[model samples]
Target: MPDPTDVEKARSQRRAWEQNELRDFLERQPESQQEYRSASGLPVQRVYTPEDIADTPFEDIGLPGQYPFLRGPYPTMYRARPWTMRQIAGFGTGPDTNGRFRYLIAQGQTGLSVDFDMPTLMGYDSDDPRSFGEVGREGVAIDTLDDMADLFDGIDLERISVSMTINPSAWILLAMYVALAKSRSLDLAKLSGTTQADILKEYIAQKEWIYPIRPSMRIVRDMIVYGAEHLPRYNPVNISGYHMSEAGATAIQELAFTIANGIAYVEQVAATGLAVDCFAPRLSFYFVAQADFFEEVAKFRAARRIWAKIMKQRFGARKPESMRLRFHCQTAAMTLTKAQPLNNIVRTAFEALSAVLGGAQSLHTNGLDEAYAIPSEMAMKVALRTQQIIAEETRITEVVDPLGGSYYVEAMTNEIEEAVNRILKEVEELGGAVAAIEAGYFQRGLADSAYTSARAQASGKRTVIGVNKYVEAPQKDAIEIHRNDPDVEARQIQRVKAVRASRDNSRVATLLDALAEQARNPSANLMPITIELVEARASMGEIVKRLREVFGSYAESPTF
Candidate 1:
């Protein structure tokens, strides 16, 4: 044989090459699965040369923010602006939330994402019997306008963007927000931020809500209309795929379901006869960054390209901004392990890296102590520091879409898009996402993937550093777990009672009666009455009860 060239010589030197060569030779004996691939399942070749990416032209893979937007959103992505740091906050009372907001701001956090307790999420006042055991259990308690006002007391609404996580009661929260900003003398137009007004996902994943589906959609439509007309800077809905992923959905399930839900929202609002381009620009998303680093990054790139194509091609959107999907990301919570909490730090780091690399607009790294409970200050600091190190110490932000044209990444992007489309087609066959969700398609998918993932973990096919490998003895020192003080409940209940006692009870009754009347009509948009009722200090339970009078409560069958 002729003398091997330098390229061939180098390729032959690697141990993996010999293994691959041996496998290639054994293919003659009997081939089982010719296509071995990544979790996203892009084909893994024995080696990649220029041949693998020959068809992926430079034009198709143009610089960031180009027509395709496959690489990144902007050419000078992080060089122009770093992704916003938004730690998911809100615990105890409004004053407590205020202090935490100030604390994060003082510590160099760039944005704020608020979390709410189970009662608040389900539209229950702290005084309600339903809210008794759960007041401020998971997050902050806001029973009326006073609590909402106190929540952002000194924080300048115009200066910093905020994201509130709430569903069925999203419009009430928005109304409270508007009132708070008005009290602070902030112009409605100058206000910025979002509300997790995504009700569809609640039925799909989170399972926290008050009203029925059609009525819930109306609430969302009202907010879309309000945000477009008055608060142009505000995102009325943060349509989330993050929680779906946290609920153990696979990456493609997260992508397809989120985009499908987005499609439903756009359609729902348009049914109200609003222009597509008006509110679509401000529509945002939240996705999880999981352990599959490269796949997660490519999924984001593919998401932008897909959404841009859908809005322009399918929805006939002319606005460039309508095509762009601005989103926030949090590292995968499902990946955390109580067995080896310290390993969580490294896990969060990798997932955060994936988020930044994936071009997330905002992010939150789950604290290591999250496996046990609410994070301690030390744990939260470590989580924040993870992002700072990646942003400042490492020079990853120097260029936009740094891995834009890697052959492996490009291949992975195509694979993920294809897989997500296949799933979307399956969803459509079931008569759209809502119908599919009702039929338990999403839950089934999650269950199957979760089972597979769990099996992998049990079999040691998946390597969790401290849990399955590099094992360590349990430490004698006790790690601190943050607990919500029970006084938050008493104070919240007392505050609601005080408002009920002092407010013009007749006007409150009148507004609530009107709400109940409109709610019974089913055709009435709840926003105007919701705003009026919130202004009148009607408790969340009162508003929920009004709706519940007409549309009966649902008992969702176990999806899996």
Candidate 2:
């Protein structure tokens, strides 16, 4: 039973309306063989009317904080509590990252999202030979508790939520976060943050992982079980689709694969001795808001509906909170360009608006200067201010899901939901996300989409403002790039060496031994040992190295 008000209103509007200006202009215009179209190859009509979304429901497409959550996760959303002003940053060493964190905080960033270098992701200490030339290169290198302490030196861990974009070695890092907060005497139960412990997606898309799929799932299950009982306020896994999009997925592919991955993780944890209603509520997700504004908005809406359905129908999620798909979205970093980079401000503004409209829990906009290097100080401020202005100046936030009843948006939402369900069916036919990953289902899909898009750009079928449509001479004067503090690695090494010197070497070894024992014995829950190691302030590398010994690293098959 669909609500009839919107449909009836649309009928009346279409019956009475006239595009007189369009009719006049077309009558005087010369006929041409060429035709313009949307990048997705959809026709560009002169206008859309209520006739477009005439069948949409006023109730099913209800207000924010309600079922379907087409509007948003909360009724007041940003009006009640503004979206987290989190900026992605981490580079050089611990102290270097700490300084950058402080700088972003000063620039009005509401939260911290840490990006780690290769060594940290691979679970290697900075001085390890395998980590040569990699530590502290692209993102911060954290190997020890001293590094973790330095990473949040002056910042109060309880006040601001932290998002650590790390997996495979997530447990070790999460342990360090808990330890640091404990050092500040912050309540363990009240610690706020999320760790990117989504290792299944590592196998699916990102490929930054240290363990085989099954062992990794076991580790993730343990973290969920542990976080439920221990760090209740902290989210254990941020099931991410941002990397999938960066890996060249179309918007729908990102949506389906990410949701399917979430399904897989929830299934695994549910099989664990814990109740489904227990930890599912703490789960969080990360997604990328792509350039197709309406399409992206629809994707978010569909995701919420699909997730709610998945939780209720599939996982038997009883709590409304458990059924809700709370997520953090960042603008597509892949869309930002080094050419006419200033135009990225315009690019980011629209994407940010789309995120707000789609009802994101929080968002991170890429810096205008990101494509070239870690954004300069000024560039970061502009990015943060971009979100602030949209929040403060734009009254869009005052209304929850203002576009909810729009014909095109609701239609697109249904379209994407159906497309994602079809893709999920195909994925299931290949034996679910992990098996699909093993078969390269996701990888090949993305490669095909990327190839198609690239060809379109090359043939000028798609218009990317400056790149394809409006050609302009390149802007002069390179963006100011931030350099690695040359002495950072040395300082980090000294800090680790000193911590290792002061820590009880025997106790550290004993805790490391216990962690190794737990990893070796699959039936043993590692949380008990991890909490002990965390309480002792064991370094991230020390714990990760022990797990690496047991579970071993993964090697992915390359694309043909």
Give RMSD (Å) of candidate 2 vs. truth: 2.9
Q: Tell me each candidate's TM-score.
A: 0.92, 0.92
Model 1, residue 551: distance off in Å is 2.5
The local distance difference test score of model 2 is: 0.81
lDDT of 2 at 291: 91
In angstroms, give how far residue 452 of model 2 lies from its true place: 1.4
lDDT of 2 by residue, 1-560 (tens): 13467557766665555356555666799445356443333444445666555555567577677765656767788778778989889888877888989999987888999999888998888777787777787789987766788888999887889999999888878877876777788898878889989987777677888888888889888888889998878999998988988877787888999998898888888876677889988999898988989888888888888888888888788887787788999998878887888899999999999998888888999889888887777887888899999988988888777777666777777777888999999988998888888888888887787788888878886667778878788877757777667776666667667877787888988989888987888777786788678667577677877877888878888773
Candidate 1 lDDT over 85-203, as tens digits, reads: 88888788788888888888888998887888889998888888888878887888988999988888788889899999898877889988987776677899988899989988888
Candidate 2 residue runs with Cα over 4 Å from true position? 1-58, 472-476, 534-538
Model 1 spans with C-alpha error above 4 angstroms: 1-37, 40-43, 57-59, 476-478, 520-524
